[model samples]
Each structure stands twice: as structure tokens, then as C-alpha cells.
Target: MALFIFRSIPMNTYELDCPAVPFETVGKTVAQVVSRIEQRLRKAELEPEWVVAANWIDDANDSLHGLKADALWPVVVEGESRLCLSVAIGRSEGWLVQIDHVRLHKAGDGGHWSSVALLRIKTLTRTHAWAVAAAMSRLLEID
Candidate 1:
């Protein structure tokens, strides 16, 4: 029953021991998801800068077509293919902690906020990164 136990698995290899709200599908397009995430973050009392960046790149068309980068980064999730996000958090130590492999999931239903999967970022160990991940998770609800 120890926390911070790392496990290697197929679906969520880096899953973390955290609490998350129930899954809720809310959007159709990536734009909607970004907006929803932004709104959620704001409601959670997170600063706009903390949200970092958000964007979506179409892989089906096999071209660098439309992409948005600001608070929410977008990626195509087909079935079990998860999207990973790397976030950097500033700390009082005068260095940034990088959180890599934050997975995202696409909810079966797309209405306002696209369903996203949450993967525990193993590489992130710094207090700042951990705090950022927890706050962002609360805002994005990727659990």
C-alpha cells in the first residue's frame, strides 16, 4: 500500500497514485477541448501562464495543417494511442522541473471538453513539477 510505486504496464505504464474526477466528455473539436481546459484551469484558480500551451496537429491527413499552441496542446488519439505532454514548472530553487509523458485521452463522446487520459509522469520528481502536475490535473481532470 505504498504510494509512489512505479509500475510498467501497457495502458498506463506511468500512472500515478492520485485522485481524479469521473470521466466526462464535453467537446467535438480540439478547439473546444482547449477552451474547456482553459476554463477549467481558470476556475481552479490557476494562472494563465501556468497553463503553458495547447494545440492540435492533424495526423490523419499526413500534413502539418492546423495547429494551436497556447495553454492546451492537441494530439490525435486513436483508440489506445495516448498523447503525451511535457510541462516545465519554475521552482524556488532557480531551476525548472520537467514533467514528461503526461498522457491525454479522447472521451468516446465529444461535446464540449474532449475526454483525455491521464498518465503519471515518472520523470517528474521535483516539488515544483509535482505541484504543477497536481494543480494541472485538478484543472484538467486527466485522472
Candidate 2:
């Protein structure tokens, strides 16, 4: 006879917020932030629902040129109830990374998807971007 061992582990969670702890998007716009995170996610195979690049301004060359200097990337987690992981992608000299949770559910039977709720934001840094990106990619991998 063969014996089998089972183990249980807690799911990892992430968050982000303003006055960012590990980083800040002081001069970055939403589009720029999203673009940066988009690249990171794609490289790590953790692509989010969608990514919006800045049309008006591609580079952070002029701080005053960019608009909507804040953005978030929505990632899906395997589960019911439409819960998803959201990262606040900020544009700055150093990238601003904030992780959090949000609920995306349909309004009614045919209504479009909408984010209903959110949890506290936990800020992180570019120094940890690759690590965080890898972990997130694993979490989202399909079996």
C-alpha cells in the first residue's frame, strides 16, 4: 500500500493605495502606468483583462503632457462570485505598484460587468516587480 500526504496553503493576496508606500505615480498618467504594467504582465505571462496605453503622450518626457496619471490592471482569479485582483499601476520615475481586490459581477441577467466592491490597497515597488509579476502569473495559470 502507498501512503499519500495532503497539504493546504493560503492563497496569496496583494493590494495598493495613494500616498503609495513602496512607490508612487507622482508624474505618471493612468495610460502610462497601465502600459508599463501591461508590458511586465505580458512578459511574465500574467496578462490582465485589458491594458490602455497613453495616446496623447507616450513618454513621460514632459510631466505636464500626460493625462489621467493613474490606472489599474484587472486580473482574474479562479473562483466563483466574480472576485478579481486589481493592481494600481502608477507612472513615475520608478513604477508605482499597488495590489487589491475587486468584485466584478453582472448588474442583472444581461447587464454588463461592473466592479462592486474593493479592499484596502497594499503598495509595492519596482524592485519587487518581477517577483510579484511571476507570482501573479502563477496564480493565474490555468490547470
Candidate 3:
């Protein structure tokens, strides 16, 4: 028999502070964040319970517009995978969602937005979810 080798890798876990993270209802709020999340995942080959939503708001004064901006909206997928989205809502009209940039480092110091393409929701691909998560992490200063 051939020799079989196995190696164990250590994993890093990130936790969220529910009391620290701030969120607000978008639009008329007929549909909650959970509902929107469900819709997004329904098209994927995954179960609803496998997904989790996390929100973040910018605490810095440099936030866009006069209103506080929603910095990061992370959707956990397939257990260890995640799709993080960042959006800013116009005080009067529809929300303007933009992809900031992606970060592969946990330090959250380097990475340029131009390295990643900013695609609209319609043009976004499921294959790019990991990159989106990295971008959101950089935007939120989370790495």
C-alpha cells in the first residue's frame, strides 16, 4: 500500500459584537435583512440555515454624506465561506451599493480598490463571492 500523509491546519475564527455593530432599516423596510438574504441565497445551491447576516456601520467622521454609512454587510456561506457587501443609501432615494476593494491580509492595512472590479448586483458572479468578502473586510477595517 502507498503511504498516506495527513496534515492538520489551524483555523482562525472571527467573532462579531452584536452590541457594537450598528444597523438601520433600508427603504420602506417591508422586507427585513433576513428576507433579502433568503432571496439572494435561494438562487444558490445552498440551504437557508447555512447562511448568516452581519451588519457594520462606519464610526469614523469620514463617512460618506452626512448620514452614517453602512460599512459592511457580511453573509456567511457554505460554513467557512462568506460574501460581504458594502452599501451607502441616499437620504432621499435608493441605496447606492459599491464594491470598495479586497484584502487578503488580516492586518487590514494594504490593498487597493482598483485591484478588484466594481460590478453591479446584476453583473456580479457567484464565483466572486470570496473576493467580495475580502473587499468588504478591507472596507470595514476588519481584514
Candidate 4:
């Protein structure tokens, strides 16, 4: 008989294949870029609520000034009937904007949510922010 031994090896989550796409800044600073995006959303009559993530900023208000290029900023927009949009500010390599459709499930007394990515648009410049807002508007059919 031969003795068998097995060892558990930890995996590095950061090693995952996450390609970074190029992003061109429309404004001189990150704050300006975010402001423009908010303006676009308002023009479409969509109320945007910026949210804070566990590994991200502590306060939502901090997003405007402390946006890290290597970190992601999540923004939640209100208007769609059943769909929701989330925008991430940056990635390891460049800036990326992703839009997802969220579905809510009711369980007993509590509820859970699931999401499917509707679009993954790499922002090449500041104009891309407006593009993202427009895509969200069209998807939600706000007007």
C-alpha cells in the first residue's frame, strides 16, 4: 500500500485575469470626471446615489475627491423600474465602466438580489462617462 498525502494551496485572487482597458480623462482631475457623469445622469432625470463598498472608500462623499486609479468606485442610479446600473471608476490597468441589470428575489421575510452584466464599456476618454449615462438611460428607458 502506498501512502497518499494532499496539501491545500491558497490561491491568489489578484492573479486572476483582469484585463485593463485604456481610459482617457475628460477632465484634469478624477473629481471633474465624476461630476460630468453626474451631470449627464441628471440631464436624463435619473437620480444617482453613490455608494461605498467594503474595500472602497469609507464615506460616499469621499468619492468625489479621493478616487484612486487602482480602486473602483461604485455608483447606483435610481429610475429604472426593474433594472439598476452600477458604474465602477477604475481598474488595475485603466478605467472601466460596467452596467449591470439587477433582479431582486424575495425569500420568506428577506430579499436578495442578483445581477447580469448588460454592458462592459471601456472608457477611452471623459466622453465615455456621458456615454455610460446615455446607455443607462436607454436601458432604463427613462425618457
Candidate 5:
């Protein structure tokens, strides 16, 4: 005879906060900060299915340039289909992080889907990276 046992974990119980341990960001550039955010998200097991986008901006005068990074996750929330977290470092804007709700609509009988952004958090500092990762992780736990 063989004995078997199975364990079922509950869902939607993830904490949407940064880890209690301190995060070090001293002397780190914007790209490094973005890398940290990606690391945290992957450590929390939310990277496999997420979509990540990165854009680098530059001008001829070399006076305006920076990198923009965005991570998107598909969610099943009421009246919404997806969520995006974006971080950007612009020439004038030091560091900006935004969380937006993404809604998909059919494009005029063409069978194409268009996405619209519904802004959630307009601006957040680089230190909020861990929090953003946590939020994305929590979304995966939704049932």
C-alpha cells in the first residue's frame, strides 16, 4: 500500500507591501534602480508571464535623454483587463513611476485590440520599486 498527501494553498493572501528588510539604492543610477525592481519582481515569482518594455530617449543636442521602463501584468479585476507599472528618468523629470489600469477594446470590427490607460498613481519615487513588485505579485494571487 502507498500513502499520499496533498496540500492546497489559499489564494489572494499576498501582502502588497515592500519587504521589511531595507533596500539599498545609494549611488545607483536609474537603470540600476530599474534592474533592482525587475529582480524583486522575479524573486517574488511574478516575472514569467509579465510583459516588460524599455525605451531609451535621446536628442541631437545631448541635452535631453533618459531611459523608460515598463512592466505589465494581465489581471482579472472588475471592469479592467490589465495593469502597468512604468518608471522613467527624463531630462527634466528626475525619476517618475506610474501605475495605470489598462483596458482593451475591439478596434472597429477589425478584430484588433486597442489598449487604453487609466492612470492610478501618477508619480512615485524610485524607492517605491519594491512596493510595485509586491503589487504585481499580489495580482497573481487573485482568484
Candidate 6:
């Protein structure tokens, strides 16, 4: 008989084969990219030059209302819903890479992150829920 055990964290984490794909490095590692995302949002800049989680910046107040730790960008490929990427600041210092995939679910009430395939996003900053959506277009077709 085999003893059964369950883990709290989901097991559908995604890992980017950055090396396997041929995108020139921006002179930074994936960790660096994530850090930049965090730093930019923390600043009091008027405009969000870099893309944010669906551009949650409040135009009138100039505030990031829906902005959470894991800023998400969703994408739809061939009618299939896919998360483009998610970025967040690290707790101690860097991004938590172990099991770093966002579990796809339906967006419940209160205007959660919704997708065409009825998926939702839960952005957790303190806990280890940071995730980045996969860019289907970029990953699928590489030069």
C-alpha cells in the first residue's frame, strides 16, 4: 500500500526555456526582468511606460488600483486563453522559481482577472504566488 500525501501548492508551474528559445538577452536574466517590473511600479512615475497587468493604472487618479505583486498580462491564441506573463517583487530578494506557474481558473465575482476561456488570476504579493503568463506568439515562432 502506498501512503498518499497532498501538497498545498499547485503543481502546474511553468518554466521558461529561455535558452531553448532564441530571444536575445536584454542584458539581464529572467530574475532581473522580474525585479525591474517590481521597481517600476513602486516608483511614482506619471506614465506606465512598461506594460502592466492590463494597464490597471487609474487615468483620473493616476493610481495603480488593481496592481498587485504579480502584474499579469493575458493573451488569447487561436481562441485559447493563455497568460502572457506575470511579474512581481521577491520576498527576501529574488523571484520564487520553484513551481512558478499560475493555476488557470475562472474569474469569480468582484471583477477578477478574466479570460476568454473563463480563467481568473489571484495576485498574491507576500506569499509565493508570483507568476508570469507565457507569451504564445513569441514562444511558438522563433527566428
For all candidates, what are the clash counts?
A: 21, 11, 1, 1, 0, 6
lDDT of 2: 0.38
Model 4 regions more than 4 Å off = 1-81, 92-94, 139-143
Candidate 6 residues lying further than 4 Å off, grouped into runs, are 1-77, 96-137, 140-143
Lowest-sum lDDT 10-residue window in model 6: 115-124
Each prediction's TM-score versus the true structure: 0.36, 0.27, 0.20, 0.35, 0.32, 0.19
Better of 5 and 6 by TM-score: 5
* Index of the highest-TM-score prediction: 1
lDDT, candidates in the order shown? 0.37, 0.38, 0.32, 0.41, 0.40, 0.32
lDDT of 1 by residue, 1-143 (tens): 77797787543212243336622433334444444555654554432443321223333321222233322333435454334344453343222322222233445664232333222222223544455455545434443
Ranking by lDDT: 4, 5, 2, 1, 3, 6
Q: Give the candidates in order of TM-score, highest first.
A: 1, 4, 5, 2, 3, 6
What would you estimate as the lDDT of candidate 4?
A: 0.41
Per-residue lDDT value at 52 in model 2: 41
Instruction: Tell me the lDDT of model 6 at 71.
Output: 32
Instruction: For candidate 3, write residues 2-115 as lDDT tens digits.
Output: 998989864212212222332332241212433443343344322222222222232344223211223233232343333335544434543333332233333365533212
Q: lDDT score of model 5?
A: 0.40
lDDT of 6 by residue, 1-143 (tens): 99989779643333243234533323443333344444432341211223333223323321233323333322324332333333455454533222122234445643334322111123333233332223222332211
> Pairs clashing in candidate 6?
13-101, 84-133, 85-133, 86-132, 86-133, 105-120
Which pairs clash inside model 4? 24-124
Model 2 TM-score, all chains together: 0.27
* TM-score head-to-head 1 vs 3, winner: 1
Whose TM-score is higher: candidate 2's or candidate 6's?
2
